[model samples]
Target: MTMSQQANDTSRNPGWTSTALSQLSSVVRGASPRPAGDPKYFNGDFIPWLTVAALTNIPESKTIVFETAGKLTEAGAQFSRTLTPGTVIIANSGATLGVAKILGIRCCANDGIAALLDLCSDVDARYIVYQINSQTDRLRTVVATGNGQPNLNTGLIGAIEIDLPCKDEQSAIADALTDADALIDSLEQLLAKKRQIKQGAMQELLTGKRRLPGFDGAWSFEELRNLVQTPVTDGPHTTPVFVDSGVPFLSVNNLVGNRIDLTDLRFITREDDQIFAKKCKPQRGDVLLGKAASVGKVAIVEEDFDFNIWSPIALIRAGSSVVSKFLYYQLQSRSVLTQIAVLTNSSSQGNIGMGDIEKLQITVPCVDEQSAIAQVLSDMDADIAAVDDRLTKARAMKQAMAQVLLTGRVRLV
Candidate 1:
């Protein structure tokens, strides 16, 4: 039998029943007290007031919300309804739509949320949250769309139909998914710690504060133009004609921290590329610095692709004195970034001009020292990237597990 048919058959058995949410719980729509910003309506010693932002602190597998950001006055509590612990809450409006959390403490929520109280004895709160989260896209689609803001009322949320299994089966599925969530959470935390270590390394190594072992040369400060073989230049001032595919045309958005991200790249015809190349054609090993909206973001060209850059990107070809990789890190240093910020703030267009970019000061070491420093930083980057890859795979695995367990395709009980 098909999975759906099997689920239906199980529901027909004595212990299981497929039903709408309204049949299992009483849906209570939340409310906001009058004079929302008034001191009289807030900061009371009574109940905790919950906002949609507070739900974010709750873990994915968790069913309880212990604390919230805001508190309500006694008068405010009279206008709002308080939900007991274990009550399921969903953010029903705004960008946080479909986000679900369970109440661990008694609190009153604003109009942006809906609370499900008095859940049936046979139902598990965590399983219900998982089921609702799995169908988040569908719930968002059902919300009214138009000039008015899309929102969900208690009636609409209560009408959602779910395929129910026996209480034992529900608990088993919830446990499996909860374990998977824990693995993902662990990986995410490790990745965050690795990134923090990388930032600290950059702060020390990029500047001359902490010297690499065996390298003890005094660094030299020079204008960015002096460090490059060619004059500091940018791409075409005017927009070029874009085509389906020919040569990749990059902008400030393509520069992602010391690396070029080809994703979401625009294209230009070969003819247009040839014309734009006259202004600033990026060669392999050249450092690209964003001079526009995202000022001072740097990326080293690792590939020798026949590509051109947009006007907002400044291309720098390191001379014999400095290596491209070393210059890229130097540009990202706090000292250089502070200068860029000052220049950017003084400009009317909120961008650093080519003239200002050429005059920006940077410190550089000997070529051999530069290469050694680059290698050390590069190794740290690889470590962080490895952790990030593992985090991605863990999340993907959890998503696949959810699909099977929530659908009853692979029964655990």
Candidate 2:
């Protein structure tokens, strides 16, 4: 059976009832003021203005949305539909179609969104929000308006069916999901805090501003080219034909945040790999920097692999003076990133060249201090990774809970 059909079957519990959404609430398509994007229509502070983009900040299980990106003047508000707090809003057009949020304050929304107001007392708004969000894929498949570009109308949203439990069960399901949301939010906040601490540590430790205890030596400044054993080099200038499975061919997209991600790597023939490796063969200790689209992202090669990089990725192998991990962190420092931004800005295609890479300068300390600083930062990274893993698991569990609890397959009350 299809997902929606399975959902319908699951709702046939002892006390649950299946109902069309129109029976529980009224759906109103939002409007936009004439002369769109005019400064006169906004910022006059008559009512908060909402667009599909602003709904992104609303937490998944949240039921109220107070602030918005723009405010409508009285004239603008006259041309728009004013939705009161507690109204459920859904984006009905464009890429944001099926995205939904609850209005936390009285607001006016643009034409791209629809508001569900005057909800019946039997329905818990949060439960409805979760139900609608979980069925976004199904909703998109059943759109009643537009051809190539899908759009949702009040008729489509209102006619959509939902399985409902009694009021208490609805509240119980919402509370359970809300508790799960709280856990996810807590993990997210903790991750942000850890990242902030790591940034501060990088700012202090990478620079000689905050020296490690028991070590006090003046740091030296050197051009990046002098610190590396090989002359700073990039992969082949021309693109090679991709094969089904052979040696991995990496590009700027493969460099994912401080590491080379081989998950979606394209492969070239071994003969092509041999040709590219002749120029810049990446080893375990070399530092890889993206010079094109994802400019300045640095990753240290952690394992031995017979992989070749694209022309946009520059490879740097540290010499005797600097450690590989230290060089990686140095490239990630704000100072180097700022310089990279300046260099890329000067170029037409927003890419830095090998020449640009060689001209870049970095501050370095003695080998011992470099290792110590890298260790401190690496430990922090490990801690953050652990929390991130937990957050991922929590989100998965919440989704599973929603599928069962919201469907009445597992009764909570």
Candidate 3:
């Protein structure tokens, strides 16, 4: 079958919308420079240098400080950085391992960073970086050569054979992909604003500064235990329990940015799901509180899907004293995670016990007010989710286009 057939679209990337895998050029592991704090090493000259940390920062612009992570005193370029504009820098190994970035400015990179350059005219630096992003999973699969620290050497990088296109077509494909990315970025920014707006709304409403319309009520401070049913539960942790197909199971990874991704889900069997249903099973309208590692992500299950949790999650169902939506908004508020982290029994990663959340005191407004506030926040969420859904479809479209165009199985005008 042609590559276009494989990607399921023919007209998207006409000139074989191109992407480069990777090539191991000159790999440098990085040097223990005499510390940035050392006066001898840090002469305080602004020489642009790249590191794995620099690559991790997506929007890093200014060179606040630089001498590069590794020192090459007069060996070849000395303090003079060697990166040219539009070069692809790959983090072969480091704390921020495997991240790739496009350099706007030329700078000397640490030995821990691998530089891929000198591509043919058909390839663009930024385009190559984008392609490598798609190839990172494959790169990771083949990382087996480092002494103890596996790395992407020149050999491994060069062998990453991706389909190619003419230079202009490559640029066009990159531009289109970048357009989708920029839309996603804008949606993300809007999501951030929504969070900030909701935070303000919460403080105002909960503090009685801004009362919702028709809110006539008094609140009695009560134990959280009195307001919520059994608030704790564990997940199915036994190995091989993961069925090839069954019910969607939620672990700590299921929670991201205070939201549960219903897509890309796993399934549990009818029998096992029934067993865990009482303890960790998630019902519609119930909130899932992260109890370990990535703590304080609160998501209310939207539908009745067969889902069980691990020990790191606390399933909370607020009783009549509160609305689940209100409580979920409260948990998702800005300071809630910080507060929860402090209360958790986190030896390595933070973890909040069901008891930790139960004893907490929150100034909850009357039910009607809580419902109104929940509605406002939920509206903002719906707006964001709409944008997210659009972006997801757009990206899927692009993926289909890539498959078809890059394989020369389809043509585009």
Candidate 4:
């Protein structure tokens, strides 16, 4: 099978897709960073190691951690039957489920993740790794045992099967998909550099360290009410009618620390946004600030998607007082977040209100300064956006390659 033929889902490969099944077989949990253990375990040169912590905010990749002290010695390696290099490791439980990484270096992980070993035999490991990653979520939804904890056991993993094809085809698929991954990683690095450049611009312009060519003026505190047009509104004091599918209901949880992940936005309906837009309909540049669950997390509603409100989320309008982009970054700055946290009502889940946000003071430069500052930051933001777009395309290319190659639709060497 060639790449083109394998890509067609309706073709013969549709049935089994030439795959295999397996599991971590043995589970190794993470170490307690503290507590009496041999100092040698942690005191050595850093090595690649993984924990669920590694999965928290990164995209799919190998070598998540840079520094590693907790590692298996030669003796430990012998006893543990660790998977060889190039094996895929994945998170099995908790907030992150089914996230996997191809191990780039010889390393081990704790309980937060399980290492799927023994890929060369019944299953071509790389191909099997792809199959496992693509299926785990669906596998997870269907498997049932206890609500106390959700997990995928070895038996569950082995039973989960894929369309079987010739091993040569499987190898071909893995190889093609790998090329796509390589392209994506390269683009991501470029994007990272663009963002770093922007951040440097922000630190200089906003701090007065480097002033752009033009007029200069002293910064002063401007009262928000007088300078601002849109005031912040607390989301529905009452609970929203949440359906699995509805208009995306915005909340602190929905707003990640620095940006809005449109992919994971919770839903409400046209009716809900209508019922709530008086307080929650956010515009393109409107800043979506978190008041309840977290004090100062801020994201902008850039998409045209209709969304409504939930507790702890406050919608702010642009009254022409503060630059939306400027305010967004300011709120995200370390100082503002720390300030908000300190002033917020502490609870199992943190909550703050519109009034509290309004009361917080901020320094304002003139409109010209605001525009100039925002321009520099906006350039940086644009650079970041461009880089992120490349990363997205890279991942998508890989996903497509996987669908084709793994299914025997494509053949490599």
Candidate 5:
């Protein structure tokens, strides 16, 4: 019977066959030039060099990489392994082990990377990459259960088992997944652009450079103390004994983006929460600032929820002079951030004292304009957030699709 007929045989579960990667391609480890950072090897233009970072640092959907940080000289190229365009490479060592990326340019890889070359006609390179990506955990497990240094050498990589289909089906599966990846990449790019636009808008709106219509108020530079209803205070100075469940305890780590993140939240007893609440209770319209460790990070508490923060957080209540949302944005302004950075003491841990936080300068406009400016920026934030949600869902969908498609459980042909 023909190979295609065999692939279509019902007895073989519609042509899906299990085989080792060694049967389909040549798996080889890359090389690194000696005496790291030598100018003779690194500062030349013979070829673009690939490092594990080049693959591991990119976003999940960014499977194709166009460039590298360093280039290799003719001497360096002699020491490194040269990879052509469209070649598939995987990081073979360190924490990023098994991470796969496709080269979009002619380059050479360092010893930390392994390239899959000379793939057979029945296999699609992208299909193999998707398969590798899906089994990243398995690849890491291979290193974890091994004898030598934690590394995924060529032998281990080649010995990996793959569920293979016929050539046509492999290409079809790869094409469908590639299209999904493209959608994800586009969404990621759009989200990045939206963030950049919001940042630019912040630069102009928060400063006096751009003014909203129907407002012609002179902006004034005021100390943070003058604009707050209460003296800035912090959470408990001492860490409390954490309970299995009760009031959520937070720290500088909870300040994610412009909002508080309660994921992996620790808990303190209700008795402890009541005690901390008496000294510093975060209410709606209050601003939370990271005063230690993460130093300039800030977030606004938008809900009237019962959660207590650690000593690393500073609580601020806005007075009638400024809007709370406005204060939140102003604290994140470039000028204010610069001031905070300058005053941050870095003896043991980066700490911005309450006194220093109160004394920092901020540019503020009339209350009416402050509200209007804050509204405009908030709308932009909402837009970016919506796109971000879509991007996240798209990524999850791609993973699900890969699980089914790569396993030949769902046939695209």
Candidate 6:
């Protein structure tokens, strides 16, 4: 027997039944007035409104829908479907088809949304939402397409087959997954708070507005060219021939969160590496600032591995006047970033010339104070990274749990 058949085998899995979703809830498509965005049809204060854009905008870890960018007046509500709190909804059309959430407020939904109303009291709305999410890709295959975007209308949605478990089992499964989601949400919130705290620290410490203890040395401003061992330089002007495996080639995308990320790297030949290294070979203690497309982004080369940068990245080797770690953090400061922004030409993709970057001013402090501030910020980054890793694992665990629980492979009761 197939997994689906095994899942619905009442003899083996007691209290589980094979049934279409329409048996448990009334599936109804939302409505929209003709000429969407007409003054008479939209932009009034009746209730929160839902669009596929808003539905998909919600964080994937959240199941409750409470907020939206647009609202509709009573006149508009007459033309749309106003669903009450606790109703399960799915984006039934366009790219967001099959995305699901439970309404947390009474709101009118536009045509792109489908509401699952009058759910049987024994059915757990959250379990249904989780099930829909697990099967989003499969459901998309049933979408009807013609002149416009693909759509899952009421008839198509009501026909979706789902394996149902007993009410108590359903609630247990939903509660377990919801707890997993809450843990992930808390981790995400903590990460954001840590980042904000680091930003505030940077604003004060890097500018000399708040000096570290035992550091009362006067601060001085110096142009970047004066403190660099080499005239600020970039990689080769032309793209090198890529190879299957050689020196890892880096562009602005590789500069992630002040560190070089080699996960999605391209490659160049060893001969080409020698040529590029002469211009912009990255080594430990050097800082990289994004010069094009993603202006002002900065990352420090903290590893001893071999890598080469493209023209979009400018390399700076700090002279004895400044510590490399201090220079890396200083480049991330608002004062320096603002300077880069002002100098960047945004006509095409934004770019700052090497000469322009070299002319920018940097605030200097005693080496000891520079090291102190950098250490504090670096510690905070480590804390945030730790929490981020936990969040990723939490999300993955939730997905795996849903796969088994919603499929009736594991009984929660």
Highest TM-score: which candidate?
5
- Candidate 1: residue 97 Cα off by (Å): 0.6
Per-prediction TM-score, please?
A: 0.89, 0.92, 0.71, 0.69, 0.93, 0.91
Report how far off residue 377 is in candidate 4 (Å).
2.1
Task: Report lDDT (CA) for all predictions.
Answer: 0.83, 0.86, 0.63, 0.61, 0.87, 0.86
Return whichever of 3 and 6 wins on TM-score.
Answer: 6
Give me the overall lDDT of model 4: 0.61
**Candidate 5 per-residue C-alpha lDDT over 67-170 given as tens digits, one digit per residue, 9 for 90 to 100:** 89879999999888888988888889876788888889999899999988988877888888887888788778754357766788788888777778888888
User: By TM-score, highest first, what's the ranking?
Assistant: 5, 2, 6, 1, 3, 4
Candidate 2 C-alpha lDDT tens digits along 218-254: 8988999899998999999998999999998899899
- Model 6, 28-87: lDDT tens per residue? 988886678888878888778788888766778799998888888778888888889999
lDDT score, residue 77, model 2? Answer: 92
Model 1: how far is 407 from its true place, Å?
A: 1.6
**Candidate 2 clashing pairs?**
65-104
lDDT of 3 by residue, 1-413 (tens): 33344344433545453222533243333333544435454433444556666555553211122334443333323533366666666777654455567666556666667666665555755556556665565566565344677776655555555555666666776676666666656666666676677678767765567777777677666656777866555565463277778877777788886788766676668788887765566778888887777777778887776567766677888888788898888776545655676787543545666677787655677777778888987887787678777657766775676555445555332
Clashing pairs in 5: none
Mark the regions of model 4 whose C-alpha exceeds 4 Å error after superposition: 1-58, 63-69, 72-79, 86-104, 107-124, 143-148, 151-164, 223-226, 229-288, 299-325, 345-349, 410-413
Worst 10 residues of 1 by lDDT: 1-10
Which portions of model 2 miss their true places by more than 4 Å? 1-12, 37-40, 59-63, 141-145
Alpha carbon lDDT at 53, candidate 5: 70
